[model samples]
Target: MTNQIPAENTLSIEEVQAAFAKSYGGLVGQLTLQNLSLEKQVQSLQSRLSDVEEIAFGLKRDNANLIKSQVTLEAEIAALIKAGPTADQIAAQGKAVIDYEDTETIASFAAANYGKEKAAPVEAA
Candidate 1:
């Protein structure tokens, strides 16, 4: 029954709904993309932290094991020296086994590698 086209500002009910839907869809898409990027970064950081923690624990355990073995070996070496041979003779035999360039200027490599942590003080003290 209308005789002329509607004005520019006038729109059908369906067109208004469609336009709103398009704008909402674009906003959702952009937010989703941003959230995905943040999620990836968070996952990467978590994985790196896990690896660092594993490495730290492994080093601590290995250092502890090395110190235990070194202590046992030192005890065995001390016992051997005390059995009969002079300390110098025992040390000379050790140098033959481990090729030390300087016999007198001995480096305590084990002591250097395994750093000591001070024990917690007793409450009474």
Candidate 2:
């Protein structure tokens, strides 16, 4: 059972096509605008991602340098521990012995020079 439209009620093929074209054009214009907006959003996200990647790379490089420095410092500490203190360091720990005459001479010199200033030389005319 096929239903048939009356000739008076039926639309012409050209009218239907014109209506479809108008609808299709409107939809296409909307889709085009949406596509452009999405593209811009994607580009903005890509730019932000690039900046984040650069920051991450710098942080990774800095972390590597810090780790290397830490390793170098640890090695130096280990070497110093194995080598032990120098002779000068050991000698510095010993008791210092000062002679009585040297102490008296230093005391006398300081007492003599205390509050005394050298006289300025006369300027030539």
RMSD of each: 19.0, 14.2
lDDT winner: 1
TM-score: which candidate is best? 2
Write model 1 residue lDDT over 11-95, tens digit each, in one string.
9889999998899999999999999999999999999999999999999999999999999999998898696555565566556
**Model 2 residue 60 lDDT score:** 100
Residues forming the 10-long window of minimal summed lDDT in candidate 2: 116-125
Q: Give per-residue lDDT, candidate 1, residue 91.
A: 69
> Which pairs of residues collide in model 2?
none
TM-scores of all candidate predictions against the true structure: 0.43, 0.63
TM-score of 1: 0.43
What Cα-based lDDT does every candidate model obtain?
0.70, 0.68
lDDT of 2 by residue, 1-125 (tens): 78988899988999999999999999999999999999999999999999999999999999999999999999999888865665343333321212333443444333343422321111110
